[model samples]
Target: MAFGIFDFLSLIGALGLFIFGMKVMSDSIQKVAGNKLREILEAMTSNRLLGVLTGVLITTMVQSSSATTVMVVSFVNAGLLSLIQSIGVIMGANVGTTVTGWLISQLGLGKFSIASMCLPIIAIGFPMMFSSREKLKLWGEVLLGFAILFLGLNFMKEAVGGLQNEELLSFVKNVDYAGQPYIKQFFIVLLFVAIGTVLTIVVQSSSAAMALTLVMCNEGWISFPLAAAIILGENIGTTITANLAALIGNVHAKRAARAHFVFNVFGVLWMLAVFPFFVNLIAGASVDIFGADPMKTATGIPAALALFHTSFNILNLLILVGFVGFIAKVVIKMVPSRSEDDEVFSLDYIGSGMMETPELSILEARKEVVKFADIVRRAFKYVPRLVTEMDEKKLRYYTDQLEKYEDITDRMELEISSYLSKAAKGELSSNGGHQVRSMLNIANYLERIGDIYLEISRNLTMRKKKKAYFTQEMRDRVAEIAALVKKSLDLMVENLEAYERDIDFAKAEELENEIDETYKRLRKEYIKKVESGKFQVRSGVYYSDLISELERIGDHVLGVTESLKKDNELIVEE
Candidate 1:
């Protein structure tokens, strides 16, 4: 086993190219699908069946179950999807992940054929990736990534081809731990499981682990049986991703982590039961696939590997789809998250990876904005509480949190808009793509709404700091206007969600017109009364500023309402 410079350099180069290729492909796919991946994930309610289906569909499409599951954890943490719902998806993900194994098995990477022809695609793709238009660049990156990926596989396969000679082959083939018993094999598998688990956890990508498996398989360093056992271990090990992500999560969120683990462990258990039988089955079939000759190499069909990965996953998906509820219950029993538990979003919906998908990211961002708006509204609620000049400390705490949420709203606007721009650069349908753009606009307008309310809070603080108070008649008007302001903001928030399901432009217009008309008349009357010396200058100045701020709040409300129509056009120009 003398190492040569060529082999050493080739191996290092192949792994580097492999990792880079995967990244380019994943990023391109993400942008192309954008938040669409999140949308597919988000619709799974408490229904285990739908969750299972959603999980398989998403993982298969994204080509990375780990990414999908991580995203699930994020959604769970965000209060978007329930633990029960996520469990089914995790089960489906395990099945979907096997598709990779099948793909490698089918492709095989055996010889000189179409496997080598993809090189030009990489050549052309990288140049296109540097374009000014995001779409062209993303498309180029995806193609380039795919070409590099196949090239890496081809290089790895070719490097090992030299090892196929009799002496080198016999050395690797004669390998055996003669004294090792069943207990030792079990421990050996466990050790590999630990290694795979550690690597996946550290790298945060199961594809890396799987790629390692492919290399080992190619080298004949591990027989198909041993490699298959390790692959099985890898599947169970990947569940640690979502579980670790749920450490700071709520009951439902914890349950999702538990469910991901539970589902994976269940799959491993079943495979263990039928391990010998399945190995024999695959061995019998592998002969027909590569041909009956032991020395006969069919390295040309690289897709065979991919096919094997796909088949294993699809079979698992079919078998386990019905068992989702039982798995969900086990996770519930394992991690019973109560409603009273520190729920950040809903009981179990906020997964950390919620921000991963462009589409789902926006939804989670929107959910966050809604919560921020509530904080703003309650800050207004704090205004009424401000009457007795309550504890300064508590007031500061409340205002501080409200302001923090406002700050968060600002961050979300940037994130949502940027993610949307990336998403728009990808492949999308007319309506689906427009929705991505729409969500971005909503995030921006909602953020502006937060800014306006936060400004009001500042106004209140200024008034209190100045020890300003309204006159008797003005006090009544102030309270009335506060009521009006709160009402207007509430409507704006409510209508943000409403207009999506059903358009009510007329009603919104009417509210704006009424607020404007009332503000004009009130200002005119206040000015006349003040000029007549009916009120002190201090009161009049306070009134004027207060009325002006309130009127500006009304303007913001109108702006938000109006922005809905222009939602789709907002991001494209920028």
Candidate 2:
């Protein structure tokens, strides 16, 4: 019964299979009910109680709390969920995750152990994968995932059972001291806690970690209390996945991940203070409820382990639920918001998001576009102010701000384009691809509008530097053109935001034509002013730059509108 390299590799391979099964199963479930899941999560997580319930329900259905937390983080990143709402869901996810332990208790350790049922399930599932019907194929995938998951667990259990390594067992047993019981117990618990944390981090799935712990306990490799300590560490380890996901996210997203870590670590902290007593309680409950002593292998410890996992989370939630606001405040302090002007560099959403599902990815991309449009609108609003400011200091301030806005738009376009390019690699419907292409084109146009603003800002800077200012009439004409371009931009955004339905497009075309006519008329009038010596040539040149940039911005805005209109039509045909 030697634990050789092949045995170790088999164990690692088994863990990989378990993780793979979890992924496949989780993804299929999401695909089967992704829209409904979104609707439920959005509609149900409005309050603390509903949010908790939504978390529990979603985690239980998907059989993975990590998936639920990642989704919640994605929602926050997408502006679909607030930080507070996310906190509530995260708390409930802690409770929901225990369901996996209970499932293993029944399926992996009972008379109908998962090991015994894996092949029959796979036999039933294998034919489903080949079904022409999409729904049947998805169902087949789910069944196969279940079978593979159990097979992996069984392989791991068998591998550990074969490792009757006396040296390892002796070290585990020697930690207890007869004269100093509390000291000995404390150190052992801490050691197991560290072990559990490392194990969960390496596996990246608490469910798999829990399964392995149960297998070790079932084989008498660890005591029930020791397993309980490891389980506590698993709670802390599970938070790492969400935190890793939040790295590319905005401040709010980072805060949500921090909140998750805070919640779990607090749960583990309090549990450690009363470790022995709590384990005893769970061990007693296992015997009373299941007619089996958890410490004895023949009676089964999986039930006791599951009970402990559930009770600990439930009690932890009850104790800390009232302080969610306090916890949120703490995380906010840990990660504060950026200063006003400094905050304009990056996109606010779609960071650390799940792009495995193209449908959801597209929705996130659209939100980023909406944010992009709003930035462009704000930048345009500053145009007339830039022109009218007479104080040199204020004029310089305005131009500098506009320049920053242009840089912001450029960064946003690049980041979002990169995101969409990755999303395009995922499976998508024809309509989905069309929508993505349109979003890319719209981003390009919006970026061009930002360039136009920069151009206008530079012209104003030149005018200010040369002591050449617009005459009242010239200012009035320029303002008129700016107002028309502003109108076109607003219309473009409206079309972009409601890109699912049919847009008039006629109104947008009319606006574009009017802008062109106005530009021609303004050019003619300004040239006459230059010829009559009513306007300085240098002033006319700057005026021509401003007017031409405004007209081109109108054209780009129109391009965005047309792209939206075309995308909407394609969606309609679908």
Candidate 3:
């Protein structure tokens, strides 16, 4: 029978359905268990072996290795996981992904019609998905997605079986390279391996590729060995998702993805070297131990292939587990760190598609805010240096640092605020929601503080360009106010850092009072000096602007401390 356009469309539609169902199921599950997944990943990936276990658990729970590895890359980008730990997790993801093939073997090939089985599931899930309650709605989606996944598989199986390409089968069986079985078989394996890799890359999902491979095998369109070779290629192809995710990330993220690629490629290389032996071992175990019949290729082949997938990953993991350090080092060398790696103004912990875990995203936002505070502190410190520097070159250098810092802080505030806003729209507790508002306010105040720093730099630049010389008395008084402003900023960051802990709110209030008093005293003293002809009136004008901006910075810092105090109280009440 000829493969026609209708059959081809049916096949493509089935594949599309399968991919859609996978995304729905994976996303719904993540919505249901995102916070718990975050906690488990954050806590469990502390060491190499534990990281592997965490990877397996998360991939199995979410039913998507690509998701797990992408999350791992995000975590590494966020500085949540080290390179070695990420490698371990990547290894476990490979093993955990094999679970999908086994599940298909059990569910897709049963005596009952998998497609028909999906009807009741969708029937039951449809109403719940649109229900008023969010919890029930999420669960309903999971059920609907499960039904759709298997329904697609059922369609694919039927469509593939309908191909009736007996000529193709005959061609595969009759192909020989001058009667050299080994050479012919080797080329066959290599050809299918390339096919598998391309299929996975096109779909961007190894589980999908594995399902298609199993379906093809179930129809005896390909032998089990060829299917296993495809599985090997799928492993290599699966790394693409994480690597693609890492493209917008930092050096550490790039290294983590490279480690994943390195690990899978190495596993494939070794498996290729021992290809025949590996296949035979898995084949023997499937027949003798798992009750699968080796002579029967069509009936028991999927399970045998599943067994091959599992065993290959497990053995590969065992071989590479001990060399995680070496792998990490190699990837680090491969992806060298750039100066901007540490200085780039982007969110490290939060990324796109992470709003599902709102509470967790808050934590990420807070981490970014902490980094923001540090940058502001550095920017503020340079203000005084710029004020005192008389050398043109030094003044320009300090001014540029302040300008860069202002831009960084501005971007950081926007990024963190945008993340929080998105996360706030998700399911969150009242306290979590309130904390988001408070964090937003804090980011706003921090941005204001950054603006004030930039303003100070501008004023200093203007004074330097005008060649305005301050009286010794005016300079000394303004320095005192600037010092007090620095103290206030320091207290503000401290309160934020120890948020939810019993903080010394009074100390922050004290710094604010000091800033206020210093500004007032300096303003009065400088005005008197100008009136008494001890300082130039132009000098007093610039000095007053400087002290006023310093006072404004103090005000914003106090605002941050106040927000932190409220946020802390809410945490305590909860």
Stretches of candidate 3 off by over 4 Å are 110-113, 166-184, 294-296, 343-574
- Predicted structure with the largest lDDT when compared to the true one: 2
Which prediction has more favorable TM-score, 1 or 3?
A: 3
Judging by lDDT, tell me the better candidate of 1 and 2. 2
What is the C-alpha lDDT profile of model 2 across 10-45, one tens digit per residue?
878888888888888888888777588887875643
lDDT of each: 0.63, 0.83, 0.81
lDDT of 3 by residue, 428-461 (tens): 9988888899989989999988888788889888
Per-residue CA lDDT of model 1 for 1-574, tens digit only, reads: 5547777687667766666777777778878787898878765556667777787777776678877887888877665676667777887777677665555444433433336557678778878978999888988988887777666766766665555544644743554432467566566555655666676666566776677667656565555545555666676677777777777655676788877776666666776666555655665566676553222233312233343445555566677667767777787788765532233344222233434455655455456545544444454554434333457887675565446446646755664566566656655556546566556665666677567556656766776688676666776666666677778777766766554656466666777677677778778888889889887777677676766666676676666666665653443444
What lDDT is obtained when candidate 2 is compared to the true structure? 0.83
Point out the higher-scoring one by TM-score: 1 or 2: 2
Rank the models by TM-score, top first: 2, 3, 1
2 against 3, candidate with superior lDDT: 2
Residue pairs clashing in model 2 are none
Worst 10 residues of 3 by lDDT: 171-180
